[model samples]
Target: MTRADAPPRPENAAAWPRLAVVALGLLCLTEAAKLVAFHQAGPMPRASDAGAYWLLGAQVARGDVWMAERPVAYRTPGYPWFLGAVQAVCGHWAWCTAIAVQYAAVWVTTVLTGWWTWRVSARPWLAVLAVLVCVLSAARASHASLLLTETWFTLGLTVCGFLLSRPGALTQSRSTVAIAAAWCLTWLTRPIGAALLPAWLAIWWRDSGVGSGGTRWRAWPPLVLTGVVLAVGLGPWVVRNAVLFGRPSLTVFLGRELWVTTFGPGRPTAGGLPSTPEAEEIIRRASPDGEFTDWGGNWSVSNRLTASGLSDAEADALMARVARQGIAADPLRAGLRFVVRGIDYWRATYLRSLTDYDDLAGTASDVRDGQREWGNRACHRFRRAWLDAAPERNLLVVELSAALALMGLAGLWLAPSRRETALLVTALIAGIALSTAALEYPSYRYRMVLEPALIVCGVSGWPVLIDVIRRGSRTL
Candidate 1:
């Protein structure tokens, strides 16, 4: 098609996405007000997780990652290092600058989400919706004001996924380096990011690789480059763990979390694990020994660990052992709960933690802990919390989340494909979500890394599903 003979291009082809980004930036700009408020929270325990992160980041700055002779296994060094760096630049309102940078990363992530959708689905509306969905993410906004890994991890995964989905990426040296860098940043920030490596490699071999044997050999260089990047970026953390805890891994936090979620007498709830008498009885029926983990709840875990005098790594390993025993004791119940958690993973809406946004850490204990009885109409506004007064927005996000999940499922299975790239993306997202479910209770916060894939797949597949149903009815 010659230029004159081609169809006319649409005017302002990218206006919707650009406008949405502008709106999102405006919303993030509002978070600056809380910077002075966050600066007021003293260095002590409170409801808000910000306190822990704040203290840890200071420790990182002082070159002391150990507190009370226990290694800081639950939190990674990336965010703390980031926080320490930001604190140096802006002493009091460090969170202000940090959120500004994070929000900027989010802005770029949303744009990339749209671009990736268009690349795979070739539909402009879907692309716009993808960007809008990410922009409106309450999880992103909530974590924006706090010191957390969600934003950085989300950006890393999106960038990594987008690079992997790019046409013929593995064949180019520069793209390979970029892909490796993206993955390293992601994995260092949150160790779970490591799981995506196998997924990406599989996608390349099966879908993204060039067709010819001569070109297939080109993949080796990129693979080696990926290995090199991981070694250089992750090697220090591994060495630290090996020396301090005798574990050559990134973190030991997973031990306590899995032990509680897997063995605790908590019901299979959508938003999170909740303690209930009925749940307790179900555990008693599953395996009487399960009651052992339920005695003091999380308090019991800490008590036992303190009494046992186990090193952090040793305690972590012991808890992991008990978790495995719980699974083996009643594999049926464990598997059922796993599927439920996976369902929660897909349907979980973003929780804003409105109180946290206000920086009222000391006052909003009830809302943050989800243990208090609010009015009859308590809205679960944040992760794992059951009351927050933001029910309307929360419900809307849930509906959007479910719609996207269903649509993505359909798209992954039935949509037309560009060498099955959509399928690869679906598998990648689902893998991350399910892996997280296995490790922690159902929380919408983890879904930040997943929103883009859901939007892309859901948008692509919905039309095909509707057409299929329509055609089947006609035949009938």
Candidate 2:
């Protein structure tokens, strides 16, 4: 329409779109910077995991059981399967393609974050601002560029939040089906993502018209959808374990790991035993057959030893057997150790034992011939540098994260309802609590699902800070 004939658009009408465009640009820049700055993916354990994922993908590519490979067994195939998909698509350029896909995923996730914050707060500028801050943060950038699953899982989580936020958006059978499908995908994306099952159930219960006369018909649709999706996503793994191994299950990776974490002997150290070994031992000794694993217990042992070695598994089993006998022999010490180890899992930095490397000696020659040689050297360098410099690095990131976290805390404090603020916080805390209670302490990345929530809280506080600044200016 001609200017004279057209009505003026509302001022806010185009603001969100403009902000979104800016956010996209910033997301691109941040991702580009990440690709440049930390292109190699710093040192071992991280590199080891990266290599293991690539190895798993390679194994899957060759038609081998992706779940049955070495050193590679610590992780599930969920992520590498995605990586393998990209590799299949890209042929010899698989690594290149994988990195590109991951970069795009990170940007998409960042944009989604901006859009969600804008949608919820209706503050377009604040949304972009949050995206920029997250992208520039070195910690986030480092993780985003890696061959790790954390970024992808985090992206799925961000998208899931965006999807769930739309009230009654999944009411229709088809829509609820899609929601259930998405959750299944999330779980397939990361085992811990199954935690979202409870989260979604909460959403379903909250949104479902359960008490209405037509509730049965209404609920039945979504319930059936959830079942179908869960069955399909998890069914194959179950069938594989059952047919091949004679045990119907979704977590074979956990079974061997639980055995390793408990009864396995580890490198002698000044500490009585590593917390992981100690916990595994406690559980192993407690079990009747000396098997540390108990899938029924929310796969508690599974999660604990997902990354542990055979030795760790053996130690875990032995410890559990000992603990069970000891608990029968003397309940007090076993109970105390569990409590203490659980706290350690919460408070101690889990970096110490990540590269324990109690068993890689057999492959040392092969490792030298493979990419792991350089990776090992890099890891050693990284460890030396990290241990030497971690104090300063820790101080810096801690201070910044803590300050932002406080901003989030204040924003949450000022929210209209205490319960409203508590939802995300409580869910995050519960997840952390479960992780601590069920598994050993992990790296900073385990808490990643909570970062966006924290960012939202911090973003919410911007208005209060602005208002304070405005009042001070007026007085001046």
Model 1 agreement with the true structure over 156-184: per-residue lDDT tens digits: 88888788887777767788888888888
Residue by residue across 155-263, what tens digits does model 2's lDDT show? 7777766676566645777767676776677677667766665556555655676644445555666677779888987788666656544556554444333233232
Alpha carbon deviation, residue 144, candidate 2 (Å)? 4.3
Clashes of 1: 2
lDDT of 2 at 246: 55
Output the worst ten-in-a-row residue range by lDDT, candidate 1: 371-380
In candidate 2, which residue ranges exceed 4 Å CA deviation? 1-24, 27-33, 40-47, 65-75, 211-217, 253-392, 395-425, 461-476
lDDT of 2 at 233: 79
Model 2 Cα RMSD, Å? 8.8
Top-scoring candidate (TM-score): 1
Candidate 1 regions exceeding 4 Å error are 1-48, 63-70, 207-216, 265-300, 349-355, 358-400, 412-419, 463-476
Best by lDDT: 1
